[model samples]
Target chain A: MPKGPGEKRQWQFLERMLLIRRFEETVVKMATDGHFRGHYHLYIGQEGTGVPAIAALKRKDFLATTHRNHGHILARGADPGAGLAEILGRATGLNGGRGGTIHLCEPKLGFLSTSGVVGGCISLAVGGGYACAQRRDGSVTMALFGDGALEEGVSYEALNIAALWHLPVIFMCENNSAGAMGMAKGGYPSLVHASKNLLLIPKSMGIKSVRVDGVDAAAVHAATTRAISLCRSGRGPVFIEAMTPRWAGSDPLWPELATGITDLRMATGGAVPTGKHQAWFEHYDPVLRLARELANGGEESVHRLSALDEATRKRIADAADFALASPLPAPETALNHVFVQEASA
Target chain B: MSKQSYAAALVDALHDAMRSDPRVSIIGGYVLGLGPQRTLTDRLKQDFPDRVFDPPTSEAGNAAVGVGASMAGMRPFVDLGTASFSYLAWSQLTNEAAVAHYMTNGRLTAPVTFHMLHGVRGGGAAQHSQSPHAMLWNAPGLEIVAPSTAADAYGLIRTALASPNPTMLVSHAKLLGIETEVSEKKSAIPFGVADIKRRGRDVTVVATSLMVPYCLTAAEALAKDGIEVELVDPRTLVPLDEKTIIESVSRTGRLVVVDECPLRGGIASEIAATVAERGFKHLKAPIVRVTRPDTPVPFSLPLENFVTPDPEKIAAAVRGALKAG
Candidate 1:
């Protein structure tokens, strides 16, 4: 049975992508339901950039992302329940509840960390890459950020250092046109932010750069594979501008934060909110489009993909349950883990 | 033990650390020629080419990457040029690196030693002159250390390299050239332990960094006046050796703090407060602090000298603490 519409491996890839979508969908619900608190940036629409691009990375390879990090975490194989538990500030979470949505990390799994600040994780990626080069770990570090990060001077510094050292890093920019703040109500055509092309900037720095349609998971995987190969062979520190679109249409949480709870129902209960941009998101939606492609492989491929979505949905439900049931960190342990907390056994 | 300049001691430690562990390295704007026309790091750079890094000019980026390297199992001595430049990387330093271990629940630890030269070095005024030890002292996760002697600079830096937590060492620019006998052999100077340089019963003078030597000088001059001043150097500020300071105060029943940092919210203030809280009953007089005024360091030598706490100021504070109450 073929996994995705194209390659047999792609179906599993699609499953991972859909699972991330399911996870993000669940996160929005949980965040709204009061299971999670504090400022949260959902990795909803930009799943294409995180999943396939991060999926290409192995266990030893480090993956760093921005505040919108769930997709990157899960695509790197972070347990859905544990991630949710962390977001819910549970003692059993990845960061033992100290790190909420913005700072999820599982170093053992090569997902070093996520930074709330824009372009913050870039230097970490460079540093990780530098360490890997020193150790000759035969591993790579990929830094994923948005077009918004390009505006940050530190991002350029990170890129320049990466290029100067030829560090084994893939600078992946998920170009959602505008960030969570500058979401064009229409689409990229209507996006007003005068964002510079990420490719041209890196190219000017003599860094090997590439661009690919991020919505196509297979395309993303193919491009990332080439980039990683270059990094592995030592002619590296590549820049990849994946034209990834965010289906969020508009800032979901801000409106809820502004209008109170009345606007929550539009996105809840799996209701597809009405709008031209929403329709565009639906048509261009990676999952739906991938399913449409899988439909070419007859009903069986489509069924398998749907089954993946359903199983992932169920898995996300269990994650929510785990998040809700897990205990908040003990009050007495507030000062714990400031330094590497040694094993108590 | 051979006498070493503060510069030589730092280089000796860096060489020892890099030689001892392959993971030990230095990252900064320029490690070579860090002081005067020549530097200890410049020598280390020639020796361990890969370990010593001259990164592009970006304090925030350099700090982030340095911390990242630390997390990736390297003991990186990240020097952010002058102490004032730390202001540029304040966000990353305080928020990201300092809080990393606590925030990540100890799954990740950055053993990065951030080095910055503080205090007013003559013409090095305003932007160049800033004693940020006070700033780093208040940050909980970051262990703060300021070495007045060449031995401690060598010993403490090595200790910081070995530490699992983030550490910031603020070396006074003036102390770098001062020659002093270090350990005969390699030694690790543990943090949170005060070194009692001179013992006297008249009054206990607590000091830090450059002020330690100034306090010692003050003690000598005051001793001529038949005023015996016991001086204490709380080498590390964060894991402050409050016990030693308190015990010293308990013995003397009087306290005066000499600090190169500002008067308000400086290490002296903290020391004064600590002695007051823990050893108030032991006090025979009010705590006095000889510190720079809470203002930007001026460029002119006269103005700078006036603001900076010197032997005269330290001696005056001792007399004040003894005479009052």
Candidate 2:
């Protein structure tokens, strides 16, 4: 059943997706400007996966994502401003500036945690599922990972255990078709074929599996609703393969080369905007699609977006200011939190 | 109070903890009688069937699950069968459970107890027999406990389970059958406290885990030779009882550390460094360490005996320290 056409929910989703996209773009600029430290994996083109997957979850449901987790964090209701502060290494960040982008967490929003290591959070979500099942709690655990993490052995192990124990977990695989520059050609024969293989692995292990058009938010929400229902009825450990594409060009060279090809404007070539090249981007600019839908509905939708955009921008600005003004962790604290110290004297 | 073996005492401690707290749970392979060494999990399952879980054979997954359960406010005792098997779950123990409290800035607490049977067990061979005390002890966030007696076993394991942070109890397989008089009532033993099993004035013998009893036996033989030996058991390796070891060495004027791990970068080396730094003025001689050679433990009985630290080696180390003093 469609969640009533509430402008509030639509605006909320649009604002979050836009915030994530803009924040990531800003961070990329910051990286270029030498203001940001460490390598950042941007979720620019894949905002659809997070928007839809998280829109289907309740406030009590928990989420654990991989290193490419900014979109997921924002989708699960973390303030984009705090997330930006974290990436900026500010104290106002979700992890108190201790964990940068790679380890962002907002437990208050049921964002359990994120791990830098690929496929590391799979078993953690399974554990969370077990906890939920043991307590007979209706809360579900969504473990989000990229297509690259499928190569890890622990992922398979976690699926097997989750299936055997009948835990309440939703394993959502966002197949971005590349594992940090290794394209599908060099990695797998095809993204969909590989996803089919993954789906089979989980199904054979007794988990219910599904494949959805991840670009379509409604499709993702429907699939998630079904998965959540099955889980609540004590029939889960479900796997969903969301066939999606990288929004930005996978490598910097590809975009540069594409621009050069268009610049040549040969006789056979036609003038098209740089944005319309990728079919995935054209059909699934998640934020744009939601905004267009909301505008078509009525003037109230536009009003909601305008108000939300202002509020979100202000929140992000405030967080950035707070983080920039905060102090860096002390040198001695570098080793702190690696382990829990004894209770203070 | 009845006499109890080290393994039995551990089982009793688990039972007592389960009876006292409803949140305590167990998960691991053969942890519920799927394997031969069914003593630990068998007793647990028999007494507390609901809490003692027979997890699938995925050490990494189970360990991570234990960390999750612990973070969710459950006291989970994860049995990894052997310390060497812990390498598979090293990421979970090191990155997740150990750091969760600090990473979340004290908002998260992982009260998970990792129980492993470490050290050489008969002819278990390379993969199964290796001691990983030094490996775990090096990790900052984890509380590493290695008890050498039934009393300390019950006390330390109970205390670790009660702790709000991640703790690991590495029990030696060889010490499983060693019987000792243990009280029926369970009690908590404070971490970082050393137990003086035997007292003397000539030299201080600092030992850990299975080597503690061997040190005491060696001390008896040294006393027969009119060489007074003091034996110290550092029940917890991470928050080491450096004060007790230093005080004992200060009184005895000599120090000898016996460890089952290899000589290079072992706990013995750390203890020796501690003595050199704190008790250097009181030391009548250089601090000596009796430990296995820097090599993989051999399968042959005589070769294993030669490589592992035993009573003979402890006695010889004491004589050498006395001579040097």
User: In terms of TM-score, which candidate is strongest?
Assistant: 1
Over the true interface residues, superposed, what is the Cα RMSD of model 2?
Answer: 2.4
TM-score of each candidate structure, all chains considered together: 0.92, 0.91
Superposition error at B287 for model 1 (Å): 0.6
Once fitted onto the true fold, the runs of candidate 1 whose alpha carbons sit more than 4 angstroms away are A1-6, A178-195, A253-278, A341-345, B29-34
Model 1 residue A119 CA deviation (Å) reads 1.9
What DockQ class does candidate 2 belong to?
A: medium
TM-score of 2: 0.91
Q: List model 1 lDDT by residue over A28-93, tens digit each.
A: 678668777787765655666678888788777877777878788888888989999998899989
Which residue pairs collide, candidate 1? Answer: A3-A11, A4-A11
Q: Model 2: per-residue lDDT, tens digit, B61-128?
A: 88888877776667889998777788998888888877777766555677889988888776766787
**Winning candidate number (lDDT):** 1
lDDT, residue A212, candidate 2: 86
lDDT of model 1 at residue B162?
Answer: 91
